[model samples]
Target: MHSLNVALGARSYPIIIGSRLLGDAQYLLPSIRGRQVCVVTNETVAPLYLARLLDGLPGFDKVDVVELPDGESYKTLNTVNRIFDVLLEKRHNRTTTLIALGGGVVGDMCGFAAACYQRGVDFIQVPTTLLALVDSSVGGKTGVNHPLGKNMIGAFYQPRLVLADTDTLATLPDREFSAGVAEVIKYGLICDAPFFHWLEANMDALLQRDAAILAYAVDRCCRDKAAVVASDERESGRRAILNFGHTFGHAIETVQGYGVWLHGEAVAAGMVLALELSLLCGSINNNLLERLRSLLRKARLPQRPPAEMTVVDFLQAMELDKKVVNGRLRLVVLKSLGEARVADDTPREKVIEALKNCGVR
Candidate 1:
């Protein structure tokens, strides 16, 4: 197992990445400070790995499992309430810990529950999907999606530990696996140029599920994200760069309706638009844009926004993005392949032009 710390001082936590870690108490037991535990997962994952996880927490005074319905559409306050009902009925107190045991949707909701329940409580992240392990699980950003926006209603609650067992990914569907690759590609586009170039040459090995390459990619992303989170835990400054393609991506998610396009898939298409905007802004050339598109295509992710979406649809949804400060839209644009900066000065017309150029009509 390989371990790294987020370096948040008092809130610092370790992230452990390895194979077959789910059923190991040695890794999980040390993180839990309380005797009561709740394992939050989804119906799809419960059948496959829930028993293995439950087997590890043998001596807890109280242990419970909340199997949520699986899907992006189910990530909401209503679904989170189910966890509250169980915790309350079982008399779990403030010291109880929440163990998120599934994908991004499960991790987000469980983390949010731990943050809200009893004001606050400890929680651990055991991200099963590649998307969660590389992005959502490491960052302390936890919340459910609002009808108006994606993750607009969440909080910044760090986990006590993030235990990512690459073994869980064995059962991930091909489409879902491809979706995860989109975020992995994002790290290279925003900050890690060499990793991007490495991905260009090694994407085939990654697609084949080469264990070493996948673990390296996951570790690299986690380290990249951990540094950002430690510097700007609440996204008050440079942390916004992490949302490189997310402004346009979140717009696609809201317009297409949640679950229609997977978050990573939408972000893949959104990155294309962001790249086009960067090209028009004179920060990047056609060569860089094409290189990213080629990589995305090889990953089996979408290279364009959904056909039914319109320029107006995108604008309306984007206006609700959290980055909008003082009514001005702030977008993370690429200054170069390995550098990005937030630009509030981007003209509304320029955004529309980029949208039109990218087939948003």
Candidate 2:
């Protein structure tokens, strides 16, 4: 197993990545004072691997499992309330630990639940999707989407441990697998130029599920993320780099309605738009822009927003994004491959021009 630790001093935790890690999670969970445990998952994931996870946690005094209807739309206050109902029904106390046993949706919902359940509680992340494995599971960011904004109502509660079983990818659909690769590529684009080049060379191997290559990618991504989180656990500054394509991406998701485009797919196109804006701003050269687009194309991720989305709709949605600070849209743009910086100074005319050029109406 390949293990990487996110150093947060007293809240430090380890992320375990390997095949069959799910079955070994019981040994990894921290032994807390309370024996109450709740496993939060969605219907789709519960059937396939929930039982295996249950088998791993043999000796807990009481275990409660709540499976919600699966989808992005279900990530709301209602779902979080359902978790509260379960916790209250089980009479769980402050020490109860919540286990997030699915992808980003599951992780966000459960983590938020843990944060609010009796003020605070411990939680573990078992991210099944590659996107969640590389990004969401590592950060302490947790929340449900608001009707007006995505991730607007959330907390920065870190998980006690994160278990990533690469074996879970076996059940992922082709589209979902491609979607996950978007986040994998984001890691390279925003931070590691060499890893970006390595992905360009090993795209085929990654697609074919070559274990060694995947293990290396996951480890490196987690290490890069750990350093960032340790430096700015509450996203005071440095951690914003992790949202490289997310500003435009969240706008896409909200404008198009969530789930129409997977989170990674939106990010794929968002990164392209960000790169174009960077080039227009004279921050990155044309050759580097082409290189960025080429890698995304090789991964089968979208490079433009859906044809039907209008420019006005996108602008309205972007205005509501949580990342916007002091009424200005804050965007994470790349200066070159493996390097990114936040820019709130980008002109609206330039952004609209880039969107138009990319075929957004």
Candidate 3:
């Protein structure tokens, strides 16, 4: 097992990454601080792994499982309320621990439920999907999506533990796995140039699901994200760098409708747009842009925004991004191959041009 700690002082927790960790009681039981436990998962995952997880928690006083309907479309307050309904019906107290046992959608809703239930409660993340293992399950960001924007209504509620069982990746579909690769590649683009180069060289091994390579990629992304989250827990400054392509990405999700494009798929295209904008703004050389584009192609990710989207659609959706300050749109763009900066000063014309360049009408 490869174990790492996210240092949050009193709220510090460990992330365990390894094979066949799902049914390991030693890992799961140690994280729970209370007798009562709730396991939140999705329909797709419950059939495959829920029994294994439940079997590990034999000592708990009470264990409840809420099998949520899966997918991005279900990431809403209404779905989250279902958790509350079950918790209340079962008379769960503040001491209850919520275990998110599925992918990003399940983790987000469970964490949100834990944060809001009885004011607050502990939660553990058992991210089954690659995206959750690498990104969403690590940071404290939790919330249901609002109709107006992605993650617009959420909380910075960190999980007590993040247990990523690489074994879970066995069942993930090819499309979903590639989506996770986008986030892995984001770390290299935003801050780790060598990792970027490494990915460029080893994209094939990763796509082939070479165990060691996949584990290393997951751990590297986690470490990068952990450091940033520790430094800017509330996204007051440096943390926003982590949203490198998310501004443009969220716009795609909002305009196209949630679940139509997976978050990672949208981010894949969004990163391309951000790269184009960076090139136009002279923040990065064309060589760097082309390199990322080539790397993305190797990963089978989108190289541009969706053809159906327009410049106006992007502008309108981005205006609703959380990064907007006093009506000015802010975007995270690359400063170099390995570094990023938040740019709110770019002229509106440049934004439109970048979108147009990427095939936005």
Candidate 4:
């Protein structure tokens, strides 16, 4: 197993990534001074790996499992409230530890529930999806989606531990697996060019589930994310680089409805848009833009936004994105393959043109 630490001083924790990590709970779940434990998961993942997780938690005398409806649409305040309802029924207190046992939706909701339950409680992340393992499970960012926006209602509650089991991914559908790759590629685009090159070479191997390559990718992604989080835990400044394509991606997801375009698919297209904008602004050359697009295309990810979305609709949806600060639309744009910058000063007209140029209507 490859382990990376998110150092938050007293709240520091470890993220373990590898095959069969879930079955090794004695090493994964440390003593947290609590008898009550709640494992939150979705319908799809509950049947597949929940039992394996339960077997690993044999030492815990009391364990409660909450199975939520599976989908991005269910990530809401109501779902989080349901978690509270379960905890309340069980009389769980501040000392209880909540284990997020599924993908991004489960991790975000469970983490937020832990944050609000009796003020606060510890939580662990056992992310099943590739997207969650590479991105959501690492950062302290946690929340539920709103009708107005995705992740609009949330908290910055960090997990006590993050256990990513590569074995769990064996059952993931092909589209879902590709979605996860989008986020994995994001880590490379934002901070490490060498990793990006590695991804270029091993794309096929990763898709085919080559254990060594997947392990290396997961470990490297986690290490890079941990380093970024350690430097800027709260996204006050430097950490915003992680948002590389998220501003546009969130808009696509919101406009199309939460689950219409998987987050990674939207990000795949959004990265294309960001790259176009970068080229237009003279930050990255046209050749680099084509290379980036080619990489996304090679992964079977979208290079353009959905044909149905209009420019006006996209702008309206973008307004709801969390990146909007003081009415200014802020975006993380790539200067080149290994560099990114958060620009709130990007011209609105240029953004509209780029949207049009990318066939976003």
Best by the lDDT measure: 1
By descending TM-score, how would the candidates be arranged?
1, 3, 4, 2
lDDT of 2 by residue, 113-203 (tens): 9999999999989898887888889888999998777888889999988888988988877788888888888888888888999998998
Tens-digit lDDT string for candidate 4 (1-361): 7677889898799887777877775755673568778999999999999899887787776799999999898999998889999999988888899999998999999999988888999999999998998889988899988888888998998888898898988999989999999988988888999999999899999999788988898889988899999999889898999888788888888888889999999999988888888877779888877777877887889889888989998888887787889998888888888888999999899899889889866
Candidate scoring better on TM-score of 1 and 4: 1
Worst 10 residues of 4 by lDDT: 24-33
C-alpha RMSD (angstroms) for model 2:
1.3
Error of 3 at 141 (Å): 0.3
Candidate 2 residue pairs that clash: none
Error of 3 at 312 (Å): 0.7
Once model 4 is optimally superposed onto the true structure by TM-score, how far is the C-alpha of residue 84 displaced, in angstroms? 0.8
Cα lDDT of candidate 2 equals: 0.86
Superposed by TM-score, candidate 2 places the C-alpha of residue 83 at a distance from the truth, in angstroms, of: 0.5
Give the distance in Å from residue 307's predicted Cα in candidate 1 to where it truly belongs. 0.6
> Tens-digit lDDT track for model 1 on 38-117?
99999999999999998878899999999999999999999999999999999999999999999999999999999999
lDDT of each: 0.93, 0.86, 0.91, 0.87
lDDT of 1 at 111: 97
Where does model 3 exceed 4 Å of error? none
Candidate 4: count the clashes: 0
